[model samples]
Target: MARTSNMLKAAMALVLCYPLAIAESEDDFWEYDVRVSEGYCVYRNKTFAAYVDYTLEEPCEKWNCYPDDQMVLEQHCPPPPGYEIPSNASKDAWPYCCSNSTSS
Candidate 1:
């Protein structure tokens, strides 16, 4: 009889504490990192320049090491609109127009 009573008490304690344990296991926050690059590349007759697209992923991957689309370069320029060249713009002028605040 004593063994059965102890077993029942243990079962009751587990049942009562299960909800609190599960709630504590829930994730409370998420973290991410933003990456930027000196957006420059040449394609076709014109030079392409602008901040690259912003992306979110697990925090483990370091900058430039992650896949192309996963880096966030949106602070200087946003995406879905790749930077376009202005009319009469010289290739040399491309750097001046598209350059970030600091020079590399």
Candidate 2:
């Protein structure tokens, strides 16, 4: 009967669409608790290497003039001479220094 044929077609359509729906659900993946701190860093091996220098020395002073001598954590890499600096260096917006408190 046509009713049986329609029901079969409907089930076939749903079976075909089920995989596409499952594929879309995978796109919602996300990472949580990604805490980033502002600090100087260098890029090595396709990853950012972080360093914190609180000396308030010459090069850092040029970037920001603050008397507090706060921890200067910037993201920079020392490439070879004449090598172009990467424009996509990571710079954390929230600047935080290493604290004596271990809770960080």
Model 2 stretches astray by more than 4 angstroms:
20-104
TM-score (all chains, Cα) for each model:
0.19, 0.19
lDDT of 1: 0.28
Report the CA-based lDDT of candidate 2 relative to the real structure: 0.26
Model 2 clashing residue pairs (backbone): 39-73, 39-74, 40-73, 40-74
**Model 2 steric clash total:** 4
lDDT of 1 by residue, 1-104 (tens): 86566445533543353333223222221222323244433222223333322222221111111122222111221111233434544433322323332311
TM-score of 2: 0.19
